[model samples]
Target: MSNFSNVSRRRFVKLAAASSGAVLLKGCLGNPPDTTATTAATVGSAALPAANVGTGETPEVTTIKLGFIPIVESAPLVIAKEKGFFDRYGMTGVEVSKQANWASARDNVVIGSAGGGIDGGQWQMPMPHLITEGIITNGNKVPMYVLAQLNTQGNGIAISGMNRQKGMGLKINDPEYVKGFERNQGRKFKAAHTFPNVNQDFWIRYWFASSGVDPDSDIDLLAVPPAETVQGMRTGTMDAFSTGDPWPYRIVADDIGFMSILTHQMWKFHPEEYLALRADWVDQNPKATKALLKAVMEAQQWCDDPANRQELVQICSGRNYFNVPSEVLTAPYEGKYALGDGKPEVNDFKAGPLYWKDDIGSVSYPYKSHDLWFLTETMRWNFHNGAIQDFDMARNLIDRVNREDLWLEAAKEAGFAAADIPTSTSRGIETFFDGVTFDPENPEAYLASLKIKRA
Candidate 1:
C-alpha cells in the first residue's frame, strides 16, 4: 500500500479556510510565505471544490508523487501545485519533489511506481520515444505518455566573454566567421549542452552544420548540468552553451557571456518540454489523469497571461524553486532579452518563450508531428540507430496506445472549445532558420536531405 493518504473533503475545506486567514495575517505582518515554499501542508487545500460527476464517472485516485527540475519552463507544474489546482481536481495528497537533473527526473519516474519515488512530472520532448525505444532505460521500455507541452521558445545559446572578445557575434551561420575564430584561436571551439540528444544538442548541431562547420570535427561538445553552464563559461572551460532560461539570462546579467541567439529564432513556435505521466498509472486512474491535465492546462493559461508575468516570476524565483534573482526570470517572461554585448533590448514575439496566444494558437498542445521531429533528430544523430525507422513505428513509440485523447478530453473539461483542439495531430510543415522544412509524412526524406547526419 502507498504510504500517502488522501485528505477527506471536509477536512480539506477546513484547512483551506484556515490557510486563507493565515495568508491574510502574514500579508498584514509584512512577512508573507515565499510562493515557492508552498507545499501540500502550506497550500491547505485545493482552490475550488471537486467537480461533480454523474453515474458512471470514474473516481479519482487522489494520491500522486510528481517530480520537477529547477527551471522556469517547469512553471506550469509549480503553479498547479502552488495555486491548489491539483487539490481542486480532487488530488489532495500530491507531493512535488525536486530532482537534481534531467537524468534523475527520468530515472525517478521509471522506478517510481514500483519503488515509491515519482509517478510523473515534466520531461523532455523526446524522452518518451527514447524510453519506449529502450535506449535510456537499460533495455527496459517504460510505457510513458506526454499529456501536455509545458512551455516553448524560452531557450537561448550564449558565447563566453573570451569568445566575445575574439569578435564572435550572434550570427553563427557564417563559415568565414567561425573559421576566423578557429584560425585565430588555433583550437577547435568547445561547446556545452545540458543533454545528449535533445533540443540543445540538435540546435547546436544544426547551427554548426548550417554554418559549414562539422559539429563532430570543428567543435568539441560537452555535457554540463544546466546550473553549471555559466560557471563553465566563466572558467574558460567552455566557449558557448545551449540551454533554457533563465540561466542564459543569468549569464548575461553577470556580464560573463552574451546571448548569441534564441532557440525560437531557430524554429518558431517550436515544442520544448512536456508534462509526462506513466501509461499504466494513467490507464488505471483515468479520472486522476484527467484531473491532473485540467489543473496543468489551467496553470498554463494563467502563466501565459501578461498581467500575471511579474507574479509568476516571483513565484519561480523563490528559494525553494530556481533560487535565482527575480530580474533574470522577468526578462524572458516579458519578452525583453539582453544581448549581453552592450546592445539595446530586443523585443519580439519569438522571444516570448512561454507563449500561449489567446484563441489563435496554444503552446501547451502535444502535437505528434513535434514528437516525430525529435525522433528524426534522435535517429539523425544515431542516438537510437535502427530502432525506429518507419513513421508508424516512431508514432507508436511516442503515442503508445494513443494517449493524446486524454489531452483532448481534458481540454474540453477545462472549458476549451472544439476549435481550441487542433484538427490534426500533425502541425504540418515546420521550417527552420536554415530554410530546412520538416514534413511529418516524409521523415526519411527529411533525414536524407540533411547534409550532416550520423545515420
Candidate 2:
C-alpha cells in the first residue's frame, strides 16, 4: 500500500480544522513571532486538508512532497499552501520543502522523498527537457511533466557598482559596454547565474551574444545561488549576474548594483518557471494530480490579482519562505521598480504569472515549441549531444502526453469556457530581443541563425 492509503478522511479533517485555526491565529500574530519547531509543526498541520473535497473519489496518494527554491517566482506553490488550496483539492499532506539550488531540486525529483528526495515542485522552464534528455539524472531519464507555467517577466540582469560607475549602463550588445567592462575591470567581466544550461544562462548569453560579446570568450560566467548574488557583487567576486527576483530588486534597494535589463524586455511574455512532477506519480494519481493542478491554478490567479499583492508580499517574506523584505517582493508585482542607477522609476508591465489566458493562446499551457527552444539551447551549449538534425526525433524526447491535456482539464474544472481553450498547442512564432523570430515548426533555422553557439 502507498503511504497515503493509511490516512482516514475523518481523522485528516479534524486535524486540518485545528491546524487551519492555528494558521489564522498565527497570521493574526504578525507571522508568528516564534520560529520554534512547534510553531512550524502547527503551520504544517494547517497546510493539510480538512475534508476530501473530490467527487467521492479518493486520491491515489493523499500526500505530496513539493520542492521549491526561495524566490519570488515560486510564489504559486507558496501561495497555494498558505491559502489552503492544496487541502481544498483533497491533497491534505502536502509539504513544500526549500531546496538549496536548481540542481538539488532536480535531484530531489529524480530520487523522490521516499528514497530521500522530492516528488515535484517549482523548476526552471528547461528542467523537464534536461531531465527527459537524461542530462541531470545520470543517464537515467526521469519522465517529468510540466503542469503549468508559474510566471513570466519577473527575471532581470544586474551589473555591479564598479561597472555601473564606468558608464556601463543598460546598453545591450554594445562595443562600448564591453570596452567599458574591460577598461573598468582590466579583465573579462565575471558574471554569475543560478545554474548552467537554465533560463538564467540562456538570457544572459542571449543578451551578451546579441551585443556581439561572445559569452564563451568575452566574459567569465560563474554559478552562484540567487541568495548570494548581491553579496558576490559587493565583495567584487562578480561584475554582473542574471536571475529572478527579489535579488534583482534587492540589488537596487541595497544600492550595490543597477538593473541592466529584465527578461521581459528581451522577450515579452516569455515563459520563466514551471510546476513540474514526476510522470509516473502523475499517471498513478490521476485524480490527485488534477486536484493539485486545480489548486495551483487557483493560487496563480490569486497571486496575479492587484488587490492581493501586498498580502502576497507579506506572506512570501516570512522566514519560512523567501526571507526578504516586503518592499523587495512588492516592486516586481506592483510594476514600480527602481533602476538603481539614479534613474527615474519605470512602471513596466510587471506582467505577473499568466495562469490562464485567452488573449495569449493559453499562456499557462506548455507549448511543445517552448520545450523545443529549450532543447535547442541545451544542444547549443553542448549540454546534450542528441541528433538535432532530425526535428521530429528531437521533439519526441519531450513528454507530450501530460503537457497541455492536463492543464486543459484543470482549466475546464476551474470554470474556463471552451473559447478560452487554445485551438492549437503551439504558441506559433516567438520573437526575441534581437529581432530574431523562432518558428516552432522551423527550430533548426532558428538554431542556425545564432552566431554564438557551441552546437
Candidate 3:
C-alpha cells in the first residue's frame, strides 16, 4: 500500500466517516440514498422485462441455488442480494449457497443433478475457460460461461510479522526489494495462492517475473486455501503468501505479515475472478441468467460506491462468512492499506465487472491475442499443447467459449451505451504490464521475440 494515486474525490469523505468509529455499509450499510448519487451513471437495469416475472411465467431456473466459498472474493454474489440488484432484474427466487471449496463447487456444476444443487455459481476468472479446455477437470467440459468478472484486484505479497520488522519494509519495483533478504536467503518464504493456473497464481508469477525472480525457483508455493492462509502465517507454516480480499488484509492487521507487493500494481485491472454458470443455465433459463447477471452487476456497482463501502465490509464479516470486525474488511475495500512496517498510505485498489460477459458472440469475445498469451503460458507450463490442431476451429472453440455479446445485449436492454461496448477484449492488446506491452493476438511471435525464456 506504499504508493497510491488516482483515488476518486469521493474517497475522502468516506475515510473521514471511518475514522470516527462509524463502520460504513453501502446499499444496506446505512449509506444514504444520496451516496448513490455518484453511482447513478453506471447502474443499469436489464432490457428484459423482469416486471412480468411471476413464479408461473418466470423461467424454471427461478430457484438459482448459487454456490460460493466463504471468502472476500465472493463480494459480488453477496452484494447482488443485499443491494436488491437481483430483485431489480426480476430474479426473485435466488439463493446464495455456501460451498465446501473450489473442487466441490466445480464438481457440483459438472455433476449437474441433485449433487449440483444449483444452476450456476461463482468461479475463478480463468477457471471456467481452463476447465472447458480439459485443464482443471476431467469430463466432457460442459458448456460453462461467465456472466461477469466479479472483482478486478485485491491482494498483495505479504511477509510474516517476523519478517515485517526485519527491515524498514520492501517497496516493489524498487532496486532495494530483494536486498533486505540477504540475511534470510536460506529461510524459505512459504507463499500461498488459491489454485494453479488461476489469477492468484498468474498474478503472483507476474510479480516474481517483474522482479526478475523465478517464482517456481525463488519461492515456495503451498497449495493453501484462502481461509487458512492467515493461520498459516500466524504459526510458522507459511512465511509469505499472495491471496485475495480479506485474507491478506486480515493477516497483516493481526501482525501476522507485512504487506510487500500489491498484486494490483503488478497487473492493474488484472481479471481477478468471476460469477459463472453452465451455458445451458443461460440458454435454458435465459431470464434467470440475465436476472442473476443484473443482480451481480448491480452489486459490483454498489461495491464501487465509496459511500457504501463500510456497509459492504460489515456484511462481508457476517458470522457465516469472513466473521472479522468490519474494520479489517472495510478499510482495504476503500483503498486503505499499510505495509505493517510502521509506515502507511492510501492504496489504489482495482474493482471492475468485465469478468461476466457474453463477448464471444461479438468480435469482442475472441481477443485472439489475449487467448494467445494464455495459450503460450499454458504451453510453457505444460498445460496445453502448443498447437491449436485446427487453428481456425481451435480459435473458434476458444472464441465460442466467451459470452461478451450477452453482456452488451443485457446492457443495451437496460438503457446503456451499447456502441461503447467493443466487440472484442484483448488482454494482449492493452500491454498494461509494468512498462511492457503484450499483444495476445500474435502470442507465438511475441514469445519468439522475447529476450527472456526458460533455459
Candidate 4:
C-alpha cells in the first residue's frame, strides 16, 4: 500500500467551487494571457453519465504509487485526487507520494514503490531511448509508457541575472559564441538542470546549442535537483540552469536567476514532464489503467481552467505535496518572473493548458518528433552509446511509453466521443509553437539539420 492519502471528490469539488480565481480560468487562458488567465473552463458535458463515472468491477492494483515533485506541472495528479477523479475512475485505492527528487521518482517506478517508487516519472529524462527501446534490464522489465504531457511551461532555462543581462543565447545565437561562452568567461559558466534526461537537461542543451555552445564542451553543468536550483543560482555555483516552475520563480522571487529560455522556445507545446506507467501494469489491469488515465485527464482539464489555477497553486503548496510556498508555485503559472536582481517578465501564450479545445489543452499532450530529439541528445550527452541501434526497437519503445491509444481511450471514457481523439496510429508532422513542424517518421533528416554533433 502507498503511504499517501486519497483526496475525496466532494472535498475536491468544494475546494474548486470555493475559488473565484478558478472561475476565471477558461476563456481567459485561451487568449495569450495578458494578465493571469481569467475564466473557469466550461465543463463541456454536464450530461456525463455517472454510470461511467464509477469504475466498473475490474481488477485493480488496489494501491497505486505515483511519483512527482512540487512543480506546477504535476498539478493534475494533485487535482485529480482533490477533485475525486481518482475514485470516479476506479482508482479509489490510489495514493500520491512526493519523492525527494527526480531520481527518487524514477526509482519509485523501477522498484515498484512498495518500499520505494513503483511507477512514474521521478525527475529523470526520457532515458533517451529507454521507453522506446524498452531497456529495463535492472528490474522487472515492464515496457514503460507515459500518457499525457503534463507541463509545456514548467521546465525552462534560467541564467544568473548577470548572465541574463548578457543575452547569452539570444544574442549569441551564433554557433561560435556558444562554443566560446565558457572560454569567453574568465571562469567556467556553470549551468543547472533538474535530473538526467527530462526537460532540464534537454532545455539546457537545446538552449546551449542554439547559442552554439556544445553543452558537452562549452560549460560545466551541474545536475542539481529542482529544489537546489535557486540556492545554486544565489551562490554563484551556477550561472544558469534549466528547470521547471517554482525554482525559476523562486530564484526570481529571491532575485537570482531569471528565466532565459523555456521549452516553448525549443518547440511550442513541447512535452516536458509526463504521466507515465509501466507497460506491464496496463497489460495486467487494462480497466484500472484506463480509469487512472481518465481520472487524471479530467483533473488536467479542471486545472487548465485559469480559474482553478490559484487554488491549485495553494493545494500544490501544501505541506503534503510540493510543500513549497504558494508564492513559488504560483509565480511561473502566472508567467511572471522575479529575477533576484529585480527584473520581472510576464510570459504569455496563445495556447496554454486546456480544459477542452478543438480538444487539446493549452498544455495538451501530443507525441511529436521533438520528443524524439532527446534520443540524439542522449548520445550527445553520453547517456546512450552511439548505437545507430534498431529504429524498430526505437519505435516500439516510444510506442510503449507514449501509450497514445490508452490516452485516447481515457479521453473517450471521460465522455469525449471516439472521434474526439485520434484513433489512427499513423504518425505525421507535429506542429510546434514556432510553426515549425516535425514528422516522427522522418527523424534522421531532423537530426542532420542541426549542425551539432553527437556527444
Question: Per-candidate TM vs. native?
Answer: 0.83, 0.83, 0.75, 0.79
Which order, best to worst by lDDT?
Answer: 1, 2, 4, 3
The parts of candidate 1 lying over 4 Å away from their true place are 1-59, 165-170, 173-187, 342-344, 358-360
Q: Each candidate: what lDDT? A: 0.70, 0.70, 0.56, 0.56
Give the per-residue lDDT digits (tens) of candidate 4, residues 81-145: 77677765557778787777765665566657555556664334464236435342343344676
lDDT of 3 by residue, 1-455 (tens): 10111231123233323333312211222222332233232212422112211223344555677887766668778777665666656666678887877777777777664565655677764567766655566746767776566665676677777655444233344424444343455555557777666666666666655556556655577667765877877876676677766666677667777776666555555555566777776787776665665456556655665555667778878876666777778667767677677666545543312222322221112233444445455444443444233334334544555654455444443432333243334433444445655655445555555443441
- lDDT per residue, candidate 2, 1-455, as tens digits? 11111222233334333333221111111121222222222221332112223245566777989999988778878888888777766788999999988888888888987898998888886778667657777888888888787777688789888766544444453556663566765777888888987888988888887777788777888888765767878877678888777877778878788888777678878878788898888988988888888777667656655666788899999989988778887778777667776666768544433443423655556665677777777777666454334555556665342366676655554444344445555678999867988887777788899888887
Query: Model 2: which residue pairs collide?
Result: 49-92, 112-117, 113-117, 173-211
Decoy 2 TM-score against native: 0.83
Off by over 4 Å in 2: 1-57, 165-170, 176-186, 342-344, 352-361, 385-390, 400-402
Ranking by TM-score: 1, 2, 4, 3
Q: Between candidates 1 and 3, which one is better according to lDDT? A: 1
Candidate 1 local lDDT, 143-228, one digit each (tens): 87788888888887888887674444445545665655568777668888887777778888887776677777777888888657
